[model samples]
Target chain A: MSTILECKNLSKAYGGKTALSHVSLSLNGGHIIGLLGPNGSGKTTLIKLINGLLTPSEGSLLVGGHPVGVESKRITSYLPDQSYLNANLKIKEIISYFDDFYNDFDKARAYDMLEKLSIHPEAKLKTMSKGTKEKVQLILVMSRRAKLYILDEPIAGVDPAARDYILNTILSNYEEDATILISTHLISDIENILDEVIFIKDGQIVLNSSVDKIREENGKSVDSLFREVFKC
Target chain B: MAWNLNSDRPIFMQLIEIIQISIISGKYAPGSKLPSVRDLASEAAVNPNTMQKALAELERSGLVFSQRTSGRFITEDVAMIEDLKSTLAKEKMKQFLESMRQLGFQKEETLALMSKFLKGDHS
Candidate 1:
């Protein structure tokens, strides 16, 4: 399979603190990969580098064989951990904005998903509850037919039911040819669907392997192995 | 019918065994429909994706057949179910015997424990 994203010796630092340090990883098409790490482990930083939200302090990131830039952005759909939308905009307006920005954005599918979630398109972002807004954002990101979907902490801070809905939405949406990279610390919940896992710690990759191989070799659940490796 | 299973072995393999057991025990007769994916997932409290994977494995093994709109059903071949049950039982028995030997339990003592456990007497 072709490599969807490749990071070579990527590093990002803010003032004297390092967020990511010489981290090298690659994602291939048609894979749902878990980007797992504890808080302050640079999971968000790595995702930012891939999405070109932040220029790497050193090294490089390539998406779909092109360097991270305008061209790469076109093929990548990013869902940041925080809400990036303007609170004043209505849900329908948000969908229109995505439609204008992305060529592959599927407005019909977005509306379908909203209908499933019972989200009112006329409701403004400022009016919806935080969890509802998160669901809306997730629906929009997942509705895009982009080559790579970079989801940062997709299920974080949500109730268990909402988490299940978000995860199921991800599993049901997205083209078979596309790749999904989900960055989160909830390893156990998402462990089954992941084809591969990239474990990041202290701004570096400590383990990256297929889920089946990890289970076969370690004879333990990925969550258990994670605890053993990154235990405090 | 849904199978209740808890084993240290891999879940997918255990699922296969459970399906075979259901067949051998006549819980799922030939031509009978199996539980839907969603139902099975909720019953097991496992990810639907994991349940789908196990079902796909069963379909590939020719032990189950799926109709796109109608859902999956058990195969009509009883011999296949019998073969699966015998193979799995032998494997599990071998492992149990090996563990007993390693624990230094002689055959007579092992039979005695089995009898007491089966008879519900703990004296």
Candidate 2:
């Protein structure tokens, strides 16, 4: 298996607060890796670093064997935990923007997904509900045929039915050779789909392993082990 | 086909078992086309990755074969499914016999329980 992403001693800080500290990890192609941590545990920071939205204060990140930069951004599709689209834009306008910017973006798939969600292309982002907006954002990000997908809290704050929909969309849209790194604290819901998991706490990696190896070695499900390791 | 899932087991493993049972029962007949991974995932309300893993496992066991663009299909080899069924059946019977023996049941009592259960007019 070829390495799709590699991070070496990555560190990030905001003023006096440390969001990540010397984190090192590598992901292979075709992996659905779960990035797990509690609140303030640096999950978002790590994702941002990988997405090149924020440069690491120290260390290096290589996406598809290239350093994090404009080139890396082209091959990386990101879905932030919160909506980042302008509220004034219509759903169709946002799709056009993605189509123009991302060479790999599939406009037909995005439209198909929107239709499935019953979202009208003429609907304004400002007028839609929070959950609806989130769904739209997800549809846009997932329609891109990027080599790496960095999804932060994809299912957070959604109802159970919508959560299932979001997860299903992710599964259906991702390319076979791509690597999807989903950051979430919702372990139980995603524990089954994950091929590998990297647990972060206090700005540091605490556990990282393939799901099969973890289950075989620990004799416990990933959810149970997460509860044990991150017990409060 | 519906799966008899155990909460204790992982969903993907249960999915593999369900597909195997389908093969055994001829619901997914030999050489017949199996459902797309996306369709199966949607039907089961599971992540596509989970379904993909199950399909991959099936492929490894020679119980299913994929044709790239055409999608996955049940393997034409009936022996593979029969082998899996026999292995699983033997393991299950072993556990049942062990439990009965631990409960102080002799061979005669075990036979009696089987006969009594089989004779019932189950609706």
Candidate 3:
């Protein structure tokens, strides 16, 4: 498989405090990787760097072997930690917006997902619940034929049923060769679906290994191992 | 149909056992085509790559075979299926015997208890 994302000696700092320090990692195509860390652990910083939202203070960051730029952004679909849609627009209008913005966006797939969720096309964004909005954003992002997908806390603060729906949607969508990078503190819910996990602690890459290897070697689930590693 | 996998073991291994049992129990009859990897992965709520790995392992063991155009199919060899069933049954029997021995039950007493239970004696 080709390398989809790589960072060499990547570091980020805000004034006197450091968010990520000398972190280096590479991701391959056709994987569902978990970027797991506690809050304030540089998970968001790494994600932002990949999405080209913030420039690195030192070292290099590359997406699809290209430095973070228009080319990289064009092939990378990102679901931000916060909802960023216009509240006044209807669901259909937002779909059109994405259709116009991204050449790879699939309008039919987006609408099909919306209909599956029982979300009417005429429903306005402001009226939908928070969980519903997250689903919409995820559906839009996954509908793209991007090579790399960066999902920032996709299941946070949602009910368990809604989380299952979101996870199923993620699994059913996406091409086989594309890669997905999901950052979350809730490890157990998504552990089964993860191919590998990169545990980030205080902005440093602590552990990177396949989920199956972790379970086989450590004789414990990723959730248990994470609890033992990041215990306070 | 539930893939009730435990967290302590590797998932692909569990998937292999699950599919093996499905075959032996006639849930998935011999010579039947298996579902696509994507469908199986979604049904089990696991990564498709992991499912593929499990299917590959099964193919290696001759429990399943794949054709170029058609997907995957369970083997039609009944003797091989019977061999797998006996192996699993022996493993379970060994475990049961070990547990009974741990409880300090002798061979004669264990046989007596099993005979009584098989005779539908509740007391």
**CA lDDT of each candidate?**
0.85, 0.86, 0.94
Off by over 4 Å in 3: none
Q: Give the Cα error of residue B47 in candidate 1, in Å.
A: 8.5
Listed models, DockQ each? 0.21, 0.35, 0.91
Which structure is stronger by lDDT: 1 or 3?
3
| TM-score of the A-chain for all models | 0.97, 0.96, 0.99
Q: Per-residue lDDT of A13-98 in model 3, one digit per residue for the tens?
A: 99989999999999999999999998999999999999989999999988998899999999999999998889999999999999
Clashes of each: 0, 0, 0
Pairs of residues clashing in candidate 3: none
Q: What's the residue-level lDDT of A230 in candidate 3?
A: 94
The docking category that best describes candidate 1 is incorrect
Which candidate gets the maximum DockQ versus the true structure? 3
Question: The CA-based lDDT of model 3 is what?
Answer: 0.94
Tens digits of per-residue lDDT, candidate 2, A78-116, equal 998888789999999999999999999999999999999
TM-scores across all candidates?
0.80, 0.87, 0.98
| Per-residue lDDT over B33-113 for candidate 3, one digit per residue giving the tens place of the 0 to 100 score | 999999999999899999999999999999999988999999999999999999999999999999999999988899999
Runs of candidate 1 with Cα error greater than 4 angstroms are: B1-76, B89-123
Ranking by DockQ: 3, 2, 1
Q: What shift in Å separates residue B35 of candidate 3 from its native position after superposition?
A: 0.6
A best-first ranking of the candidates according to their lDDT comes to 3, 2, 1
* Model 2: how far residue A217 lies from native, Å: 2.1
